[model samples]
Target: MNVLIVGAGIGGLSLALMLHKRGIQCELYESARELRPLGVGINLLPHAAVELNELGMMPALAAEGVETSALHYYNMHGQKIWEEPRGLAAGYPVAQLSIHRGVLQMKLAEAVIERLGAGQLHTGMTFDSLEQDEQGITAFFIERGSGQRVSRRADVLIAADGIHSAVRRHFHGEADQLRYSGRMLWRAVTEGEPYLDGRTMFMAGHQDQKFVCYPISEPLRRQGRSLINWIAELRVPQAELPTTDWNREVPAETFARHFDDWRWNWIDIPAIIQGAKAIYEFPLVDKDPLPRWSVGRATLLGDAAHPMYPIGSNGAAQAILDARCLADRLQEAGAGAGHTALELALREYEAERLPATAGIVLRNRLNGPEQVMQIAHERAPGGFEHIHDVIPENELNAISIRYKRIAGFDPAMLARRTTP
Candidate 1:
């Protein structure tokens, strides 16, 4: 069976790798003229790390990325709210990874190209539309530079095109709208000395205005220069969202005001903001979970299937999970039964994932893991003398546990599932 994957971003490329591992023939089409490394840092929790380990990419990833040991939260005053061990430290079999999105994409893309060969990946092919029948699925495309139309037939089509997917529009129609989160974010990466242990993922301040910073590379072990990735978010009045392009630059001064007073002992927030090489702004947004993702032989995956707010660091992780699950189901269906098998697998995948992701979407908006800091901020109104005085240890632990369950990274869940 032949599979045609749309959009060569993290999801599409990961899907290709997973399908290839199952000995399935697949081709990936990307809209860009060339596959360039893009975007900032992304976190891969233990759950997703299992998938990467299965694909034999974890060792290489570990060499290029920081292995996060814990996730720490702090109040706006720079006081530590809570810190919990993560990944192997948290007792999971896999380690959490913090790496540049481009690095992750390049690693997966290179792996796929090496295994699947150069002919399988077609760049500069813009998707126009798709038509599906009982026999197979046909996708129409245009050469991005020449504007010439092209078409390909495959047993199944997987739309992993991301938030602004054209394949999603072809199936869901034009009415699909992205919901705004009333928050705008500015993100940038700077070459800098390591902060904290150089393996910690840190979150500070409040939802209206917050700073999440982490190291994407290890400087100590290999003389590699550590890259610090930071994002500043602020609550804003509803407005049209910015284009979803990763490289769209926004001035650092626009959002730096929120962190001006963040004088923390671990790191200087304002200084980091002022020193960033470039900053890009994007409104925090997500689409409501769709009722269905499969329409005959064509189905959506990743952001195309369910675009969730990027709060729990599940954006790329969920996409990797989707690719693995779909590939497993397809492999089970065998060669001649591709269409029927893919549709059934898509349905089952949606049934299992949609509700879980919807819960995360709402939870991230309402109370994610950061709720501890929010509660601490509210109870102490003024900064606290001690964290215990603001909230009890068990209560804080409960909040973290709830979020882990919702995000599908709790120890119990991770323990039950076999790696890969």
Candidate 2:
């Protein structure tokens, strides 16, 4: 069966590779003229890492990225709240990898090109629409460079087109489906000396104002150079919101004020903000879980299927999981059962993923891992001489455990699961 994939981002590329591994023919269409290294860093949790390891790309990823040992939590004043071992350090089979999103995308794309050939993965093709019949699905596209129209017929079409997916609009219609979470985020990367344990992921500040910083590359410990990625979130007062664009630049000064007092011994948070290369601003947004994602031989995947809040580092992981689940279902159901098989597979994928992701989306807004600081602030009512005096050690441990379970990273869940 010929499968057509849209967008060629992480999810699309992953699906293509998985299909090739299964000996199924597939083609990928991307809107970009050429793949450019974009975005900051992304974390690959053990659940997602397990899938990529099976693909034999873990060693390369490890070489290109940092193997994070633990996640650290702190207050705005730089007081340590809690720390926990992650990935292999946490006893999972896979290690947590933190790498630039572009690097990860390139790695996946290179694998697809190596196996599927160059022509099979077409750049400069913008998806316009799709039509499906009993026999197959025909996808319409326009040449991005020349605006020339073209069409291709495939046994199935999978839309992994991302948050503002055109295919989703075609199926669900352009309604007020996307919801703004009232929190705006500013992201930037800077060259700096390694902080903490060199590869630790750090979260600082309170819920209303928070900052997450982590290393994206293997630390040059001798040279004291590392690629640091950071995200600053603030509650905006505006009732109406702006469109979601990854390239939108935000003035660093607007968010840097919150970190002025953060004089941590390990690294200077305020200085890193002032010296950032560039800052990309985006409002935290997500869509409500849809009842279904499949219609005939056409279906949605990744951000198109379930756009969740990026708080839990599950965006890429969930997409990776979707690709594996979809491919497995398709491989089980041959040509004659394609339509029904695709629908059933999508339903099963949603059943397992929707509730889990929906809880994460809502919980991220309410009480994520950073809530530990919130409790500390409340109990102290101002400031604290010691964190333990305000909050117990056991209570903090419980909070971390709850978040792990909700995010599908708990040790118990990972031990039983075979695939992401």
Candidate 1 per-residue C-alpha lDDT over 37-127 given as tens digits, one digit per residue, 9 for 90 to 100: 7888899988889989989999999988888988999989988989998888888998999998999999988998999999999999999
Single out the weakest 10-residue window by summed lDDT for candidate 2. 238-247
RMSD, candidate 2, Å: 2.1
Q: Rate the local accuracy (lDDT) of all candidates.
A: 0.85, 0.84
Instruction: Give stretches of model 2 more than 4 Å off.
Output: 219-223, 243-246, 335-338
**Pairs that collide, model 2:** none
List candidate 1 stretches off by more than 4 Å: 219-225, 238-247
Estimate the TM-score of every prediction.
Answer: 0.96, 0.94
Query: Which predicted model would earn the best lDDT?
Result: 1
